[model samples]
Target: MQNFDYCTPTRLLFGQGVVEKLPEVMSRYGKKILLTYGGGSIKKMGLYDMVKELLKEFTIVELSGIQPNPKYDPSVLEGVKLCKENDIDVILSVGGGSVLDCSKAIAAGAKYDGDPWDLISYKVKAQAALPIVDIITLAATGSEYDCGGVISRTATNDKIGYVDPLLYPVVSFLDPTYTFTVSAKQTAAGCADAMNHIMEQYFCEDSTILNDGFMEAGLKSLMVNAKKCIEDPEDYTARAEMMLTCTYGCNGIYSLGNSPTGWPLHGMEHVLSAYYDITHGVGLAIITPRWMKHVLSEKTVDRFVKYGVHVFGIDSHQDPFTIANQAIEATYKFFESIHIPMHLKEVGIDESRIDEMAKHVADNEGLENAWVPLLRQDIAEIFRASL
Candidate 1:
């Protein structure tokens, strides 16, 4: 096992009706609140009224319509302006990961006089950030429990994963009931997103047996429960398990003491999402198996064998290469079975921009330093194969 230092400071208020505790939690942060959300789903679900009723004693400032793959221009900049103008004491993000992500960036940016992009792009490091509290309504990205958020610069077609310990949420309200109304498409995509998080850590070179087992179980649970969710969105147990699984996805606890893989699939998928503005999880599902196939070799076959046997229950008696191939195929089929568009073309990506994307990923994401060390050509080939 590798050496590591880990801490997750977010206070989790989990289970049904936990949002009722919002008033008590918000009291600690003061009355000046920046309420952030995406679209108007919370209002449609009646959560907006409930939250408003609970916090009627507090002064609330609203920043709505935060999009998925959260943008920097209007959302981040506008949020910073709101915080500065209102003397916002705390930010309460009440939506999915994207809203919380934008809130995180806003938290960091509000304290800095410079443009928020400087903080997001790592051109400047954050010294201090405003406190953040969130109520999660989705089971993807795990932003509630992590300090990293993926932000997109639309003009440059750049999506960057910004990480700073200052960005972790001070509190996260996780009521699975909030996710009961999630659409079928998002349910599957969220599962794919969470599963890929575990796989990224599991496939690394230096991993503990205990961590591997934990990840394998997480993958199995997500696969099974995600299907249950698709079959019946109101299944409380399935929604709860799926919600918890994704909450743990990007927090680094599942991979403690493990060598980093540089998360090559995410590195590549960022470019795709940056260029096309497609769904983040769907892009990951389409790229994962293809990247797995491209990176399979003698050095990586043993890991794939273990993945096949343990996660998918593939026949272990077969040769290592065959087992590896079977594992990759099983991964592809599982994502497809969940109704994820398994090809880039199906998601409206074509070959015209493959070269540009590959070059951008290679230049920006540093995939050449990944566990398998993919070159620009290798990444382009994986993109081609994914198509």
Candidate 2:
């Protein structure tokens, strides 16, 4: 086991109808609330009205249209303005992880006078940030449990995973009922996103047995229940388990005391999403199998074998390489089975920006830290393979 220090300060209220607890949770922070959400889906689902009715006593300053792969431009700038002008005491982010992640940035930007880009770029540390309370509607990202957000700078095609323990939410409300209305496409993509979160941690060179087993169970659960939810959207048992698995993903808890594998999949996918605004999970699904193929060698084949037998139930009688290759094929098939786009062209990403994206990822994402270190040419080749 690796030496580590861990802490999760966010208070979770999870279950059906737990969203009604928002007022009680927000009351502690003060009345002026900066309410943030994405698009108008929440309104269409009647969640907007529900939240409004629930928070009738508090003044709500709304920030809407925070896009997927959340942007730092208008939302953060506008939020900072709202916080200053309204004297907002707290941030209440409702809807998916993007909204919550955007709100996390807003919460920090609200307290800082300098350009918020500094914080996102890690040019400086966050001194303090507004208290954040979130109501999650998406099972992916795990931003609710973790103190981090991935924000995009459109001009630079930079998607950064900005993390700061100072930005941990004061409260997070998770009700699986909220995810009941999520579309099948997004539901599957979300499952893929969460699963990749575990794979990134589990595939690390320095992992312990404890985290590998925990993550294996998580992967199997996601695979089984994701299919169930896809086959029957209203299956509570499947939805609940999928939601819980996603909740634990990307939070570092699944691999607590486990060593880091450098999160190379994320490094590669960040470029796809950052450059083309592709869906994070779908990009991950497209790149993961190809990345596994590229990185497989004597040093990494054993981990692949374990993943095959443990996660895929591959029989051990076959040669390890054969078993490993089958496992990668199965992964691609699983994502395809879920109707997720499995190729870069399928996602509308082509060769136009591959070289640029490869260079950008190499420069900024630290892909070299990967278990099997990937250089710029290696990243470019992986992108080409996905193409």
Candidate 3:
């Protein structure tokens, strides 16, 4: 096992009516709130009204319409302006991971006088950030439990993962009821995203047996519960378990004392989402199996064998390569079974930009340090295979 330093400070209130404590949680921060959310889904689900009614006494400054693959240009910039102008004390992000991700960037930017991109791009490290309290409406990304967020700059077609411990939400309200109304497509995509999060950590060079068991169980649980969610969106037990599993996805707890895997699939998929504006989770699903196929070799087949035998319950008494290949096929089929568009072309991405996207990922994503050590040509080949 690898040596590590870890801490998860985000206070979680998870269950069926946790939002009832929203007012009490907000009281610890301040009265002036910078409320951030994506489009109108919150209002449609009546969460917006409930939040307003709960915090009627607070002075709210709204920064609505934070998009997925959260934009750094307008959303982060505008949010900083709102915080500065209004002297916002705390940020209330009441949507999915995208909203919370955007709010995290906004939180850091509000404290710094320089451009937010400086902080996001790591040109400048953040010293402090305004407190963030979130009500998670989706189970993907696990941004509520972690300090990292992926921000996109469309002008340059750049999507960067900005991580700083200062940006962890002070409190996260995770009520599974909030996700009961999630659409089938989104629920599948969210499941795909959370699964990839575990896979990224699981496929590393070194890890504990205990960590592998945790990830294997997480993958199995997500698959079973995701199907149940598709069959019945309001299955409380399924949603609750899926939500809790996902909350641990990106927080590093699942991989404690484990060697870093370089998160190579995320590096490749970030370019897809950055260039095509495709769904983040869908991009991951399309890239994951292909990446797995590309990276499988004598050195890595044992891990795949274990994954296949443990997670998918494939017969382990076969050739190791056969087990590895079977595991990859099973991953692809699961996403397909969930009705995710399992091809680059299915999501409006095509071969035209494949080379360019591949080069960008190769240059910027540091895939050379990945578990499989992919170079430019290797990345391009994986992209073509994914197509």
Per residue, candidate 2 scores C-alpha lDDT tens digits across 285-310 of: 99999999999998889999999999
Q: Roughly what TM-score does model 3 have, to 2 decimal places?
A: 0.99
Q: For model 1, state the Cα shift of residue 97 in Å.
A: 0.5
TM-score of 2: 0.98
Q: What does candidate 3's lDDT look like per residue over 272-322, in tens digits? A: 999988999999999899999988889999999999999999998999999
Off by over 4 Å in 2: none
Task: Name the candidate, 1 or 2, with the larger lDDT value.
Answer: 1
Query: What shift in Å separates residue 249 of candidate 1 from its native position after superposition?
Result: 0.7
Name the lDDT value of residue 122 in candidate 2. 93
Would you give me the overall lDDT of model 3? 0.94
Candidate 1 regions with alpha-carbon error over 4 angstroms: none
Query: Which 10 consecutive residues of model 3 have the lowest summed lDDT?
Result: 342-351
Worst 10 residues of 1 by lDDT: 362-371
Q: Backbone collision count in every prediction? A: 0, 1, 0
Error of 3 at 130 (Å): 0.3
Model 1 clashes, total count: 0
